[model samples]
Target: MEQLATFGAGCFWGVEALFAEQQGVTSTTVGYMGGHTPRVTYNDICQGDTGHAEVVQICFNDSVITYSQLLQLFWQNHNPTTPNQQGPDFGTQYRSVVFYHDQSQQQQAVEMRQTLNNMGLFKAPVITIIEAANQYHLAEDYHQQYLLKRGKASCSL
Candidate 1:
């Protein structure tokens, strides 16, 4: 079966690129999520006042890649310990978050985060938020597969 997973970890450009290269990730859409705006744009998110985070919504085949494995990638790819920030990006839009689509996903997200915390994986506490999936407004066309289109492997900060 296919499943949906949404995450906000730094720039969506790199995040989308990373997942796009993953084995089971069938598709990815860079977007804005966990916000109140009805029709948010990349500009609005950049302002950092929309309560939205730059996120990538991924569709994956569970048979090939477990949600737990995806969670591990999420934890490993970004610094979840920093609140409302990641690398050179600093704002709520860059916050680390996991948007669970179902009760099972919710449980998994919570447990994974807790496990990382218990392990003291970082010098500081992990502040990544585990929240219910919210409205995901797809970003402009130019934003999708940005790295790939530009022939760049990743976002440079």
Candidate 2:
């Protein structure tokens, strides 16, 4: 069966583009999560008051790509130590996070992060959040796959 994983690295554009090309990912959706409001706009997320992070939800076939594989990709794609920033994007809304749907995912995220830390893979400590799935508000159509069709989309992770 297909399962879901949610992550917030930075601008959803590049993140979505990167993951959409990964093997075993059934689909990807850009959205906002870890916010108080049920429906938050992109502008509001940019403002940071919404407490929402621009996130991507990946639907992948577990048989093809394990959750651990996705975690590795997440670690490789963005800077997790900077705290609320990736590449040029700087704000709380761009914080690095991994939203897990269950205990297995939670354990995997935690273990993978710990392994990275032990391996000194990151120059600084990782700040990626491993939390329960929060309300995920889908982004507008234009923001869905901004980088695939548009070449000059946000390059921030």
Candidate 3:
């Protein structure tokens, strides 16, 4: 079955690159979500006034790759302890977030976060927001698969 999972783990470019390499991910789109404004552009997100976080909406085959697995990948790829930042990127747009597509996903994300917190993997508490998936405004064409287009494996630039 096909399922949707959206995550904000700092730069959408890196997030998109990470998940796109996964086995069951059919497609990945970089976008803005959880914002008050509508039809927000990349520039609007850069300004950090739109209340939007750069997110990557992934379409995957659940039968092949479970949502739980994806959640694990999310945790490993970015620093969830930071409130409004990831790596060198600092802003509301770079905050960690998990936009659950349904009740099942919400439960899984919450559980995983709790488990990770108990495990003491990080010095700080995990601050990854778990919320219902909402309005997703697709980023400009140039932003999609940015790293892939540039033949880069990660977001170094």
List model 2 lDDT by residue over 1-157, tens digit each.
Answer: 7999999998888889888888899999999999888789898887779889999999999999999999999999899888888887899899999999999999999999988888898889887888899888999899988877677544632
Steric overlap count per candidate: 0, 0, 0
Candidate 2, residue 142: Cα displacement in angstroms equals 0.6
TM-score of 3: 0.98
Instruction: List candidate 3 segments past 4 Å from native.
Output: none
Model 1, 1-157: lDDT tens digits are: 9999999998999999999999999999999999988899999988988999999999999999999999999999999999988898899999999999999999999998899899997898889999999888999999999999999999875
Please list all clashing residue pairs in model 1, or write none if there are none: none
How should the candidates be ordered by lDDT, best one leading? 3, 1, 2
lDDT of candidate 2 vs native?
A: 0.89
Stretches of model 1 off by over 4 angstroms after superposition: none
Scored by CA lDDT, what does every candidate get?
0.93, 0.89, 0.94
Model 3 gets an lDDT of: 0.94
RMSD of each: 0.7, 1.7, 0.8
Candidate number with greatest lDDT: 3
Weakest 10 consecutive residues, lDDT, candidate 2?
148-157
